[model samples]
Target: KKKVMADTNVFLDRLLNYDKENMKESTVEKMQPYIKDKNFRPEQVKQVSSALVGLCQWVIAIEKFYRVNKVVKPKKETLGIADAEFNAAMADLNVKKAELKAVDDRLALLQQTLDESNTKKQNLEDEFSNTEKKLTRATKLMAGLGGEKSRYTMQSESLGEVYSRILGDVVLSAGMIAYLGPFTSNYRQELTEGWQSLCKKDNIPGSERYVMANFMGDPVK
Candidate 1:
């Protein structure tokens, strides 16, 4: 506002100078028309420059106030600001590709983990099948009956070896990376202790162990 006053005052002085400086013909002939002009004064130029600068500053402040305080906020697709919003949308789209690629990497890693877990589970199943085959043969040889026998009732020393193998065989199962040992041995206890240490570090509770254990170890019964 002060700058506007200064500029107005200078412009008024310019109009006044034309009347005062009208000189003799010899002096007027010696003077350049450019030098005689009301608009050419240095003070007049500064005043106009200041007023323009002030006007620009005021316009910028109004624009910023409209942006922040929002006396009237435009929509996503506003009339005059579409170019600005379009550029922002394109920038977001450019960023989204990298974000989606990171998600894809995580999904790929999870899929590989799942596949490895399944393969290990299949190997455990094969081990179980082999153990069952051996137990069947031992039962037939011990009973001398050419038929399957109850594992619990037979209790012979040689067949007990097969029972111990069944109890101690390393096995794998679904949804876990670590392998575990048999049902009747301390392998499960070892695994539990190790996992407890890990879970404690991670601040997870022990109740999840039942599910995690069954997933990591062979069945108990």
Candidate 2:
């Protein structure tokens, strides 16, 4: 309101100055030509001049007010709009930063999980390698054991064959002794010599030596 009043004062001052500068020459000189023919009355000319001055003053007041105040308002409104846009842009940036942080966190978790999986895979591979090595050694040991078993089996069979031959020889010799001893006492020396020779040829221990050591001093029964 104070500024409006100040502009009104300035407008009134301009109007008065304009009227003063033209008071001598413009108003009267312009009216003189028409006044000579009495086409305009004195009272009517005064009213017209007053109306024109008032109209010009009013127009100047309005135009000055518009020029002065025009500089003050739109800049504030544009600044407000700019501030709003800046705040919105900042908010969007903050949201994007939060989203990026979340993505980084998720990526970190995934990397950790992948590292754990790789460690587990490496452990499993090592275990499998160790198992394979153990299995190979076990297979080799089994093969060696099978060879030993086969050799032992062959030795056992050879022993069995030798035992069977020795048993047969003993039975035959015992039968010969039983049949010859009672009826051929005079031929005993000759028969013992022949038995010794047979034992030597067969690569067997002498049964005659055992018999003489144990049974010669005892009854047959």
The number of the candidate with the highest TM-score is 2
Lowest-lDDT window of 10 residues in candidate 1?
167-176
Across 147-216, the per-residue lDDT of candidate 1 in tens digits comes to 3445445657655654443322222122124445334347666665666666556654444334444434
Candidate 1 stretches greater than 4 Å from native: 1-81, 145-221
Q: Whole-model lDDT, candidate 2?
A: 0.65
| Model 1 TM-score on a 0 to 1 scale | 0.29
Each candidate: RMSD to true structure? 33.8, 16.8
Off by over 4 Å in 2: 1-73, 156-221
TM per prediction:
0.29, 0.41
Give the C-alpha miss distance for residue 108 in model 1, angstroms: 0.8
Which ten residues in a row are the worst by lDDT in model 2? 208-217
